[model samples]
Target: MRVHEMTITNDFQPQYLQLIAHRASTYRSDIRIRFEKDNILLDAKSILGMMILPFRPGTVITVQTKGTDEEEAIEEMCQLLENKTS
Candidate 1:
C-alpha cells in the first residue's frame, strides 16, 4: 500500500472526470481518493464516485493504492488532479 497527498486543481468537469476514471482503470492497483476532513473515500476508477466527491481547487486529498502498480498509480493520479499534461 502507498499514499500521497495531492491538491485538487482541475475544475472537476465531466470530461476531465471521465478521463480520470479511465486513467485510474488502466492500473492494476486498488486505488482510492479520500477527503480526509470529511472521511469521504471514493473508488478512484468509479466515475460516479469521483463526481460525487465534495471538493474544490486547493483541497488537499489523499491518494492511496495497494497492488502491483501502486507507485505508478499514485503518481498518475496526482498528475491528473494537478492538471498536468503528459
Candidate 2:
C-alpha cells in the first residue's frame, strides 16, 4: 500500500470530482481518500463517494492506494489534488 497526504490547491467542484473519479477508475489499484480531521474516508473511484468530500483549498487529505499500480496511482492522485495537471 502507498499513502500520501496533501493539501487541496483547487476547488473540489463537480467537474474536478468527476475528473478524479474518472482517473481513479482507470487504475487497477484500490484507491481511497481520507479526510482525517473529519474522519471521512471514501472510495476515490466512486463519483457518489467523492461527492461527499468537503474539499476546498487548504483542506488536507490523505490518499491511500493498494494494488499493483499503487505507486502510479498515488502519483496521479497527488498531481490531481495538487493541481499539477489541467
Candidate 3:
C-alpha cells in the first residue's frame, strides 16, 4: 500500500473525470481511489463519487494504492490530482 497527501485546486471538473477514468483503466482492480476525510471513505474513481465530494481549492486529498503497480499508480494519480485545472 502507498499513501500520499496533496491539496486539490479544483473540484470534479470534466477533465478530472476523464483523467481519472484514463488512469483507472490502465490498472486492474488492485488499484483504487479513496477520498478520505475524517471517517469518510469515498470511491475516487466513480464519477458520482467524485461529484458528491465537498471539493474546493486547498482541500487536502489522500490517495492510496495497494498492488503490484501501486508505486506507478500513485505517481500517476498524484499528477492527475495536482493538475489544478478547470
TM-score of 3: 0.74
TM-score of each: 0.87, 0.90, 0.74
User: Which candidate gets the maximum TM-score versus the true structure?
Assistant: 2
Question: What is model 1's C-alpha RMSD?
Answer: 2.2
Colliding residue pairs in candidate 2: none
Q: Lowest-lDDT window of 10 residues in candidate 1?
A: 77-86
Q: Could you give candidate 2's per-residue lDDT for residues 1-86 as a string of tens digits? A: 99999887766778888888999999999999999788788999999888776887778889999999999999999888887433
Worst ten in a row by lDDT for model 2:
77-86
Which pairs clash inside model 3? Answer: none
Runs of candidate 3 exceeding 4 Å displacement: 29-38
Off by over 4 Å in 1: 84-86
Which one wins by TM-score: 2 or 3? 2
Q: Write the per-residue lDDT of candidate 3 for residues 1-86, one digit (tens) a residue.
A: 88887777876676667668566658653445544554456555566665566667777778877777778888888788787567
Task: Answer with 1 or 3, whichever has the higher lDDT.
Answer: 1
